[model samples]
Target: MSFLYFDNNATSRMDDEVLQAMLPYLQETYGNASSVQHKLGRAANTAIERARIDLADRLGSTPKEIYFTSGATESISTVLKGIAQAYNRKGKHIITCKTEHKAVLATCESLGKQGYEITYLDVDAQGNIDLEDLRKAIRADSILVSLMSANNETGVLHPIEKIANICQEKDVLFFCDATQHVGKLPIDLQEVAIDILCLSAHKFHGPKGIGALFIRRKSKPIQIPSLVTGGNQEHGLRGGTYAVPQIVGMGEAVKRFEFHSQIETIRDYFESELQQHIEEATVHARGTLRIPNTSNVLIKHVRSTELMTKVPEMALSSGSACVSGSRDPSHVLKAMGMDDEDVFCSSRFSFSKYTTNDDIDLAIQQIKRAVTQIREASPIWQMYKEGLI
Candidate 1:
């Protein structure tokens, strides 16, 4: 059976170009980036620096502002923890939303145990943070406000720009988890007024195990207090031997994204075609502004896992890859005010530039057939047919 992979949001398949760019680093150019005397070290450093420039360029930031780590989770932890420590002299309060990824939420939770207070802001029915609520939440004791740019499960784009502006007015530090949104959508740091931003490369067709954190120059200089205090690497924020090949691959992935302005166009087309083919499907276009590569749909009367099982050839997920095993309804859907039925029946489909129209058609057919098969066996659908639903 042929397979269709629609789970880009979980982790995208490595792009061929990225793999090609990383070949030398993995094969011949293997050297520690911290070495200063060896030619191999210089070569590795060159590749890493070039990749940094590519990522910085994509975000409209200088390379100096970009700090590499072992993917978005570490980057987020480093930033959140670093900011909290650096500014602890000022206050002990932090703010975030209920829909944040486990990385951000768990970090905040750990901080809460350490005497820091956290305020998880509520979202509207559309999965948007209320600016008025945010304004009320801001206090002199608030040290940081961490919000996600786009929700990992629902692809809902939060009003980060507005939130950042608000944080600025309140003189509070702002951090954004753009792990799901960075490469899939366009981001302008200067325009967004974000103080700190985090991104993972694998979510955008790059290799896993590599990510970057962007710290605004205006923010008080960050000192992570050393998560790994040895060798004094990653500007002393994170200390470990750098993964050269993965970083090189991430840079190449960013360069590839630069040429693909029409990627979102492809995703929009897929959404339209899917809507046309599946009458019972309800697409959750999170908010007015969503990343073009993602669409979460609720197909009533069919459980998301059941639909996936029915269509074994398609690679899809019920929600964020990180929380796939939880059995609990998606916190993102709940934050959006979705009922139990809607949340349980929802599945996420994310596209990449490599996804063609043919893939979309095949996915639509698979989903329709799968829904039909599941609904045929569903008691709710049976009851509806008997006028008992």
Candidate 2:
């Protein structure tokens, strides 16, 4: 059986156009961007600047504010650690929600061990943080507020505009880990007032090992202390040689980006079909604002691991790919008040531009069969059916 890919939230397939644009850089144009003495190096430098400008335009920032990094993980570390180090005299307090991606959470955890006061805001049942809770958490000594634009597991969207405004009112810098939000949605930094934003190109249709961080430079310019120190690259914010091909691919990906309005329709249809076929199957983060591509569904009493095992031809995940090897239940769902059993029973099926209605139809069919098979062997499922629990 030909395998179907529904794990786009983990990483998307690179676009053909993006790959074509990157070929020259990887082959003939293979000159170090920092080596500006030769013509080839000058050409490489010019391409990097062009890519930076294109990414900056799409992100609603200037070229000077864009800093390229390996990916969102590195970007998160740079922002959180740099901010803590640069602004330590102002305060040591930082705020973030419980449902953020592990990249932000881990960085915050490291900061906490270094004597930074980290305030973890709780989310409601639907995976939304209370704006009032955020408002109340702000302090005179609070230096930054870190939040993600969307949840990687549930696709739940936080009210970034309001959160940015709240942080702005409190005179705190706001950093958004937009790893899952950037290419899927339109992010106008000018309109949102976010102080810092980070995104990885592979989350879209670009190559891996390349991403960009956007810092606010216009009003109330803030300085983030350099995290990676060596050469004078990325305005001396991040140092090291640039990956020219990946950077070119990233630029092309952003240049060709067009939000697929049909993605939400396909996701909704998938959920509807799942609920219609699989008894007691329910969608997580339903009725909440989310990115169009993700659907986290709970198949009652059926472990997602078993379901995936039964349908080996379909690609899926229980939660973030960062912790896929871990046997632990999803931290995002646990934060949303779900029990560990139900969290294990849930699986995430994310789509991309390449996903189609027929693909979803086939996936639903396979899932229905898998759920039935799993539940047939599950004593818990049998007890639930008999109403004996």
Candidate 3:
């Protein structure tokens, strides 16, 4: 049976071009990028540097500023803990939002045990952080302000430009986990002063286990310790041999994914189709500034888990697949002040450039079928039909 994938936020399907580009490195020219002497090594090293240039050009940054890591988790850990260790004397206080990925939140929690103070900024009803609340939270000893460029579950966007300005004025380092925004959105580091940014290739169309960290350098220099030791790779900031195949694949994926104007139309059509079929569905953060390719909804009287199970051919999810096994509702929805039912009924549907109109239509049909089945069988839904809910 054919399956439809709407879970791009969790991971993307690798493009054929990206796979073809990486095949040679996985077999033929397989040499350590750190080896500078042999021809194969030089070829691999050159390919890695070319990938760096491509990533930097796309992000409007310099090649020297990008550091390759295992993925976004490693990139985030390197930045947050590295900054905490290196700049703890400057300040132990770091401010982040409540809706951030587990990568940021867990890392901050780890640092808290080491005597760092983390302030989690709450989001408004639309999942946007209050600029005034952030400004008020800033202190003379605030060392870093970490936030995500786009929310993983709701696709809500943060005001990073303003936040960047605040951090700059306060002389505090800014870190952004831009896993969902890097390829889908137009990001120009030249325009926004993000001190540190992390993104994963798998979030785009590239292979997994490879990502980049963009660190903006200052004249006085920002000191961050190495997350791993020895071999002195990634400018001695990260250790271990580079995964040449995945890095080359990420570069190839970047070349294929240019932001087009029509992406929002596809998302809008899907939302329109969904609202038409599921009349009582509540689209979360629909009016807020969101990434063009994501749509999150909560169909009343329908349990998302049951809906997903009822349509196994539909590759959709309730929320972030990173925490997929958790039975609890989304923390992101809770932060937006959604009631327990809204949280329980939430479902996330994200798309890629490769996602077609036909795919969206099929997904909509599957969702409608699933919702009808789940709601028809529910005792609560029956009570609501009699005006009891």
**TM-score against truth, every candidate:** 0.95, 0.98, 0.98
List model 1 lDDT by residue over 1-389, tens digit each. Answer: 56888898999999898999999988899988888589999899988999999999999998988989888898788877877887788899999999899899999999999989999999877777889999999999998999999988778888888999999899888899999888777898868889889999999889998999888786456455655567777677778888999999999989887436566777777777777876567778544677777888888778898988888888889998888998999888888888888899888988777788888888878878877778777788888768896
Off by over 4 Å in 1: 259-262, 385-387
Models sorted by lDDT, best on top: 2, 3, 1
Give the Cα error of residue 300 in candidate 2, in Å: 0.7
Clashing pairs in 3: none
Per residue, candidate 2 scores C-alpha lDDT tens digits across 19-100 of: 9999999889999999999988999999999999999899888898898999999999998999899899999999999998
Which is better, 1 or 2, measured by TM-score? 2
- Best TM-score goes to which candidate? 2
As for candidate 2, its clashing pairs are none
What is the Cα-based lDDT of residue 99 in candidate 3? 95
Deviation of model 2 at 127, angstroms? 0.4
Candidate number with the higher lDDT (2 or 3): 2
Instruction: Give lDDT for model 1.
Output: 0.85
